[model samples]
Target: MADNSKARVRRLMPEDAAPYREIRLEALKLSSEAFGSSFEQEGSQPLDYFRETLAKTDVFGAFVEADLVGVAGFRRQAGTKQAHKGYLWGMYVRPVARGTGAGKSLVKAVLDHARERVELVQLAVVSDNEAAQRLYRSCGFVAYGHEVHSLKQGGRYYDELLMAVALTLPST
Candidate 1:
């Protein structure tokens, strides 16, 4: 296992789009049920699409000695009423980087960044994904709801747990 103590997390810039796309696609292909998007959907997109996405979303990358091993993204909810909420999406860590604290670091980076702009950060995890659910709980997220048959792939349905963490302290 790699030492994630030295792992660094930072916001991805447009110049890092290539590697970002690579890892994002790898994640989609490797764990198709974990994400809403698929390799076929994002893989066909041009580099400029990822560049634009990098510019628009707060995507954080976890790097271990210069190699990006994990990534997570944050995006504020659109529209006036929903502005107080943000979504944490596309979270993935390379298999080799698992259990090295990279996933935790990536979640931390997203939550830390979301703290400044939103009151709550939310994410969805497949109900069977116990490892990811544990990671989110460790990072302060709690399950607010569950959606049955939330995702359909390969003619099968996946239930999902909706989780959220409040970034702001309660008013005293």
Candidate 2:
């Protein structure tokens, strides 16, 4: 595995939606238990959906030598009562990019984006995914609760651990 220190992390633009869709499908197919959406469901969506999502959500990508290798997404809660919160969603690092700084860089990018507009950023991890749990914890996320049977794939139920990180404004 390549070390992630050299990876370039940046916010993805609308033009990058195609590659983002490709990698997202790859993630859903290979790591079904880790995400709430299924490959079948997302694959059937129109290209416009992906483009619109990319244009609106705070999605970040990690590139290694011009090849996109990882992705993370953040979106602020959309309501008057929930405006202070955001969600950390659709996090994935390509197998080849694992252990490289890609995962951490993507997370840092998401949290940095979240801090700009929300006071808390929340996410969920498959209860059994230790590596991902560790990654979130390392990013300062802490477990707050568990959602039993949060997702069902192939008739199997998967539990998800809810986690969140409080964002503090930088002191002037």
Candidate 3:
């Protein structure tokens, strides 16, 4: 296992597009069932598409020394009523960095960023992904609902568990 004790998390910039794209594509191809998007769909996109996405979304990367090992993204919900909520998406950690603390650090970074801006942070994990579910739960997320056949890939369906963490305390 890599020494992820030295792992650091930071918001990805436009200049980090190439590496981000590399890891993202790896994630989609290696764990196709974990995401709603497909490698085929995103792999065809140009580099500028990733650069623009980095410029727009709050994507965070975890680096052990100089190598990027993991990534997670957060985005504010659209519309007036949903403004108090934000979605956590596209979380991926390289296989080599799985047992290390990279995933937790990335999740913490997203939650910390979302703390000041939204009341709740939400995410959806494939129902069978126990490791990811435990990670989210350890970070204070609770499953609020479950969706059957939430994702379809290669003619198969995946159920998803909707989870969220409250960033703000309830008023007394």
Candidate 4:
């Protein structure tokens, strides 16, 4: 659905496994350092796995006409002590759609979903990924810490900047 010439971000349905998997595998392959999951690990997963995940998590896809252009995922923490927290993950925008507002729309949709169910939302970005970090900051997420050796690839480690945003104002 187009809204005033803007691509609309919609939550993926179980039948969207094909397009979702296509974009996800592409993201993992094109920007391995930006995601925690490897292309090999996710690529081997069956179509049913994608469908199951779509059913479980609040994953949203940005579509330009009938083609899927971008995707992001959100999940709330489980368990009593941590149930108030949620996370934003797997954020990726197709290179062609980078400057077309798909990335920002995906993030804003995730934050809007998170605000409904959790008090805080968290996400981590590769330490040197300045563009992604800047996007998150513009959405009101602030860095709280940095984790060293967060992910390793080919014997090299990458640091991650941990960030979070409070969905609700502090109680007085």
Candidate 5:
């Protein structure tokens, strides 16, 4: 949140795929403990991989003075198992842009999409990632349970807290 009034948010375009991938891989690399995958696992994914992901998902980016500073993505839960829900993923705000409402804006953009279009939004945050957990909670998410050793990399296990926000409330 460098300057709240200076940030602009828009749907991520095909042209943004490359820069998006670069920053995303950087986040995974630098904060693997807070994420499910390692940098090595996703760093090698080509720009085309991101292009394909963008093609299939609802993605948005926050720009500050024309520089991409934050990104968040929404994807539908697949199959008959959970088709009514959407998954929120790939959320990141540049270190300098955090805590200035840019993160809040990015989250609101995701929730805005889900509320009118999808029934539920689900996300997983690493147990020790307190900052992210606080952000999500402040944005209206509620945790149901913890998935122990939910993800493993580099010979260590990381726990995940499962969270969800209901986009539509039940009618009285």
Candidate 6:
């Protein structure tokens, strides 16, 4: 899809799972080093898993016409101690849509949706991913610290810089 025009950003529905999977798998394929999961890992997951995840999470998609251009989402961290924090993950925008505000919109939507329930939204971006780092920064995310040797994939290791954005409590 051409990226010159503004893309529409909206909350994801159950029907959007296939497109969501397609773009997400594409992202993982193009830059395996930048991702926490590999195509081999997520590709073979049952389609139901994608559908179920899409249905349950606070996810948003950016579409150019009907083509899904980008997506971002959050999942509540599992545990009584950490349940107040939502972890942002699997964010991607097509290369063509990178600077067209798609990423920002997708992320902002997820953050807005999570704000009522979670006080913190956590994420990790590879240290070398400047575009992603800048996008996250613009959304009020701050670095908590860096984790050396945080992930291992494809016979090589990678580090993901930890980040979080605090969500203001909903006004009474």
TM-score of each: 0.94, 0.93, 0.95, 0.93, 0.88, 0.90
Cα deviation of 68, candidate 1, in Å: 0.7
How well is each residue in 1-172 modelled by candidate 6, as lDDT tens digits?
2224377888888777788788878988997887777899899987777888788887788888988998887788999999889988888889988788888888887888889888999999998788899889988999998988787875777788899999887888
The TM-score of candidate 5 is: 0.88
Per TM-score, the best of the predicted structures is: 3
For all candidates, the clash counts are 0, 2, 0, 0, 1, 0
Per-model lDDT: 0.92, 0.90, 0.94, 0.90, 0.82, 0.84
> Please, what are the lDDT tens digits per residue for candidate 2 over residues 61-106?
9999998999999988889999999999999999998887789989
Clash number for candidate 2: 2
Higher-scoring candidate on lDDT, 1 or 3:
3
Which portions of model 4 show Cα errors greater than 4 Å? 1-5, 169-172
TM-score pick, better of 1 and 2: 1
Model 3 scores a C-alpha lDDT of: 0.94
Model 5 bad stretches (over 4 Å): 1-5, 169-172
Best by lDDT: 3
Q: Candidate 2: TM-score?
A: 0.93
Better of 3 and 4 by lDDT: 3
> Model 6, residue 99: what's the lDDT?
86
